[model samples]
Target: MQRPNVVLIMTDQQRWDTLGCYGNEVIQTPNLDWLASEGTVFDSAYSPSPSCIPARACLLTGMDPWNTGILGMGRGGERHMGIGFEHTLPGELAKAGYHTQGVGKMHFYPQRSLNGFHHTVLDESGREEDPRFTSDYKQWFERNKTGEYGMTDHGIGWNSWMARPYHAPEFLHPTNWTVNESLKFLKQRDPSKPFFLKTSFARPHSPYDALPYFFELYMQKNLPKAQVGEWAAMHDVPKDASSTDAWRGVRSDEDIRQARAGYYGSINHIDHQIGRLLSYLKGSGLMNNTVVIFTSDHGDMLGDHHLWRKTYAYEGSAHIPLIVKLPKSMGRTVERTDAPVLLQDIMPTVMEAVGLDIPQTVDGKSVIGAMKGRSAEARDFIHGEHSTCYSEEQEMQYVTDGRVKYIWFPRIGTEQLFDLSSDPYELTDLAQRPEHREQLAAWRQRLISVLEPRSAGMTDGDRLVSQAGKPFVKSPHYAERLARFPLPF
Candidate 1:
């Protein structure tokens, strides 16, 4: 049989429970829901770093954060620093005679770094860090010549909690443009070669501005309220209630409602665009020969536990949705597994599915076995961490195996444990409970063993050490890459 076409569809900072397949009833994600129904869902997927740059680095290289050379959000000026990888997902596939193309937000430095794709049509969300950077979406928006409304004309800051209807028309929305470009690629792709295309969306991260119709769709519905943990009083009080972009603070009911409305609306809108893409694939008779995977770089906190943004070890930030739809020729049945999977697994999974060799440099194992219900033990657990992003106290190292999660705050030397099976929202902290002491200690030791091998001074081989928090530090490999491919800025 011919190698199946690969299409990776990703959304930025989306939560695991935001789709109907994940028990989100209020949101209209029929397209994704159908995909999940017919495919296999990894119910306990996570982002290793729980932020954009680092998580995406893992996806591209199929390596953990330590190997990816990105710890947290890059360093001070390193946010735009380029990453060097000897083997990339698209690059490896391209070598196997697949036509590789990427559309939408790559979030790469110099903005246009293709990494491995044969071609890319970018939309970096109006980010012009590089002087020569101009996204194809931005260029199209300009050339179409409609009105004075710019992409940010909605007046929403990129990472703000502010919510509103997109001031521009629906056709001009970046989500629409992303799908349109993907459909165009499908239409004109090389007929003789299998294709690997990544279609990424920038919304559901922030600037929570959906089209007016979608905004109204959820505004009229009763959205779920944000759940705060019993031990989360430290973040319940607003450090800056007046700031629209505050990362941690108590938000009013109306504020949280509006944000959820816009957020849910944006997800629903993206789902509709996905429907459009799926429709095209079916009409073109390419659906049966294609492998479709859906996931996100990371998840948004979305006011959960009074936290507003990402980079935390909490489920709201780290947990993500992972669904894989194999082609009809594979004859796979609908399946769901609670195995702990990460973004890095995608690269090897795609490689295995297309009959390519998994690169030696990759740290992630292929999940094709899990997709076929052949492997239930993907990993014992997942260790995730992030350097200080919003505050020193927020720096965390966590371990989870889907049923429970243990988080360690190095700056404060505090620990929190949650039983995710019973309390998926993490409403209670079990770290201090007497009966759960052994469980907590076991999870803590799991993290300690994982960190002991690193030179980041996180562990002393015997126990975790507390320290004053500092800005993120780049790994040696990352530093070398930045030096070789120094940013023009």
Candidate 2:
């Protein structure tokens, strides 16, 4: 059997419900919708850790964040520097006689470290502070764009929720560049062997730089209101008039609405680019042999719960779209599955698809069996956690099985339980309800079971014990961030 080629397309900070296939009544994601109609959609997929480096590290290493040894954003001091991964997707596939190419935002430390891809074209997006920082997209922008322009030359802050159209031409956007580069790779790749290509997007993240047409499309629609739980009221107040608040702040309803407009626009723009990639594949006859997978590293809050960014245990920050399209010859077709899965599963699933080894080090199970209509849950519950980004309260952990979620804040010893089956929006907290006490306790026991073995001092004998100073940076990785090594640039 000829091994199938692989095209793994991922988005940054994109939510689960933004696509037309995900029960989103308002948004129009025609390309992604078409992909979903033809592909196998993992309806309950999530990132184990809802942050960039940690989540992506899981996708790259096929291990949970704990085993991958990247518990926080891989930045800051020596120990906080780039990833120290044991294995990588491209690295493994390249060993299996596949030509691998990586394009766009890897978010890996030392910026340019091509972990496993045979070669790469990076678009790290004005991230000059990274150790080995050079952006292929920026260079292309300089060469092809009519005038000198900062990517964020528009009045929007890099992390702002402000909505605005891109200042440059649409082709100059990194999303288009990602597609263009992948197309170039398709034309130039080694034709003798199977290929594993990854095209990752850096947008819909922030600065809300959607193309004008896309921005206008969502701005004109009757958008859904942001979910504001009664529990979210305390942190919902705007701290300042400014749109960019690193920490929790009050944002106006208008501000959130406009932010949603930009976010949806960004999603539309990415979807269009995916269409371009798909068209190229179909035209080039690769469609018959290539398996296409679409997903995001993590999700954006998009003003959900008054929270604007990721690292939260909420569905807004954790839930993501997972669409996998097997080759036409596979004779297997399922529009969607309710099976709970994670981004880490991509590693072993792709390995399984290409007839490669599924390593023992991988914490994720391959979903190939389930994709082929085999009975497998993949996981009973996914363990997710992230260290503090801005406040001590941001230090949290969670476990969920699609219908229910248990959130624990170890520092303050706070807990939230949501029955997603009835309250999909998570508007009410059932933790304090007497009727749900046993269920709450059972969820807490699950939390204890997950935390006790980690040695992070978050638990003691089946009970959560708050530790002093809040070990925001998990160790070994924490110690590495404290140590020193020469940077790339």
Candidate 3:
């Protein structure tokens, strides 16, 4: 019984339904579909937080954002929370006698020097917006540099909607560079021992710059139209929102169609890259011994409900794709499991699959049993949180049980409840309905019970004090600053 090698491949802002195996006929994700067919695909998987940094922290630490105090972005939050830089998944794997390496966007500070990995390739020199890194992209056009083209600035959000041209060489895209680096690492691996490699692709997140071939593939396909609802019109979205959704202001039938075309094209591009990586793995003789897990940090709104990005608790943003390929002992060939899982579960699951002891402090439960075809009670409930990002807004939390979802907006004192079974789009709010009051109370208590234990030890001094007196941020500039400097680590 030798320990298995682990390869955790993650993409930024990918939706669960984007893959061909997930019932999406327009996007061709042959590699991901193959992984799903050869492994266990958890139909319901979610991120603990909808935002990038917080969700990533949870993934690497196997703890909730609140538990790790990584509620926001930047070094400030990580430092404030006193989360030692050494407590990540790779660090734990390294301690357990496994070689750990990472490539692409891990999204942590000190972007270089193994956050936990024994080796990291294609590391960005600084934040994407840093002037030194600007030359990496050609269409970053300084005048149009809304600050979203690179990782350094959070001013402009990156998404398919803001399809900027790339002037730099094709290799500058993080996904391209990450896969190239990962292949290089694979070539140098020691076959006698187990290894843990995290290959993160930073495309499909935004500035949707794909090679012309990818875009061309989808340009000829007929994509689905955007989903919009009345409630979406009430909130003030950012300017880049219009870039992704041509109908943001015009709402013409044709505009929605065009947006969908471009969005699907971006996803196709991601799938092609994934296909390339998987082919290399199989050709290199690592496919049989390696356990490959493919998933995403969070999801994109992609014009769902008129919202263009993540951070919202809507299914379009919170739900993600999760596929795990275990060795023969773990079973094989597309057994669809109805297990309720979270992104945080990935850390523990990988450790368990590799025969390592699960850390007691980690909150996620290993799904090894489920992967082995054993029946078990699915998770009782999945929780998610969204702190202010690019906005000085009140904090929000969500809890769901696959059928119903409850969202708590503390700042506006408004709560939203959605019957996911009936309304998958989350277009209607049932909070004020008298018949649903009891259900609301039950869900609220469930949320409180789950959240109370995590907040029990917090002191008044540790509260998110900076957000107490500020008005809810509505400006994109303020939102950009918030993205660069998030709060209450």
Candidate 4:
């Protein structure tokens, strides 16, 4: 059997329920919906650490947060630690004779670390922390500026929830550029070798600036209102509500609609670009021998539970969409699996698809068996966490098995339970109810056992300990990676 070319398309901060296939009827995602119809959708996929750097680290190394040395956001999560990873997805695949190329936001530190891809074209928006850093997308924008306004001229903060139409022409949007570059790569790739192309997009995360047509397309529809839970009243009081980038707080009905409109528009724009990529693949006769997977790093909270961004264990932030389309020659029909999976699984799954060795160092399991309609060894549950980020009370640890979830806030010792089978939006908290105490206690024990072996002392074999005020702890591997940085003169 010949190895298949692999394409991994990922988005930033995109939620699970934004696609038409996910029961979101108002959104326009025909391309993704078509792909889902022809592929297997992992219904319960999640980010093990629901943040940018940590989640990408898991995808890169096929390791969970503890093994990847990235437990949480780590106060901006911009630490230069690419040197810490001894094995990466592209690096391992490259060794197995695949020509790897990455296009779009990698979010890896050192700004331009290839992590073993033969080449990479980046779009690291506005992150010029490396003094001499500039993205390929920005460089192209500078040369092709149609007017005086730059990409950021929309005046939306990079992480802001503000919504509006993009100020520039639709062709100049970064989302369009990302797919254009990928198409160019497909046209010019080394045809002699199988290719591993990771096309990552950096939108639907914030500064929700979509093309004017797309922005209005959603605005005219009756979008679903943000669902706030009964237990979220404490956070409903406007804290930093005046800021465009407020992480927590309630917003007016009009404000939430504008934000959702922009967000849905951005996703629709990406979906249309993906349609272009799919068309090219079909036209070029590559569809039969290519393995294409689509997913996101994590999900945006999107005002759910009065939370505006990620790091929460709620379904809005932790759950992500995962669609895997196997080569047409494989003879597999469209399927949906309820098995709980994580972002790390992508590594071994891709390895299995291309007949490469699944590196022994990786903690992620391959889901190929399940994808093929066979009973694969499945996990009972997945544990996820993030250190203090937007606020001290935001530090959370959660365990879920698709049907239910339990979140524990270490900073305030608060617990939340949701029966996902009945309430997927998590509108009600069951942690305090007497009828659900037994279930909550069982879930709590599961979390305790997960944290007991960690070096952070988050749990003491018998119970979860409070971790308030203490500084964020870095895994030894991450600390060593950060230590390798050269000192300033």
Instruction: Give the runs in model 4 whose Cα sits over 4 Å from its true position.
Output: 76-81, 483-489
Segments in model 1 whose C-alpha atoms lie over 4 Å from true places:
74-78, 469-474, 483-489
| C-alpha lDDT of all candidate models, in order | 0.87, 0.81, 0.67, 0.87
* Candidate 1 vs candidate 2, lDDT winner: 1
Ranked by TM-score from best down, the candidates are 4, 1, 2, 3
Give model 1 RMSD, 1 decimal.
1.7
Among all windows of ten consecutive residues in candidate 4, which has the lowest summed lDDT?
75-84
Compared to the true structure, candidate 3 yields what TM-score? Answer: 0.82
- Summarize candidate 2's per-residue lDDT along 1-489 as a digit string, tens digits: 669999999999888988989999888789999989988888789988887778888899898877766665622112233544556788889888999999998876677677777888998876766655568888888889877676778878766777888898888888899999989999999999999999999887887888999888888999998898988876755553344644356677887788898999889888888899999889988888888999998888877777877888898989999999988787786677777889889999998887788888788988877787775645778788887665666678899888999998866778899999898778999999999999999888888897777776777766888743644546454345334333445
User: What TM-score quantifies how close candidate 4 is to the native fold?
Assistant: 0.97
lDDT of 1 by residue, 130-212 (tens): 77778999899887747876878778899899899998778988999999999999989998999998999998889999899
Q: What lDDT tens digits, residue by residue, belong to model 4 across residues 9-121? A: 99999999999988898998999999999899888999898888889999998988878777777562334445557789999889988889999999877777777788999
* RMSD in order of candidates: 1.7, 2.4, 6.7, 1.7
Candidate 1 TM-score, C-alpha based: 0.96
Model 2 regions more than 4 Å off: 74-84, 130-132, 240-243, 468-470, 477-489
Worst 10 residues of 2 by lDDT: 74-83
Q: How close is candidate 2 to the true structure, as a TM-score?
A: 0.94
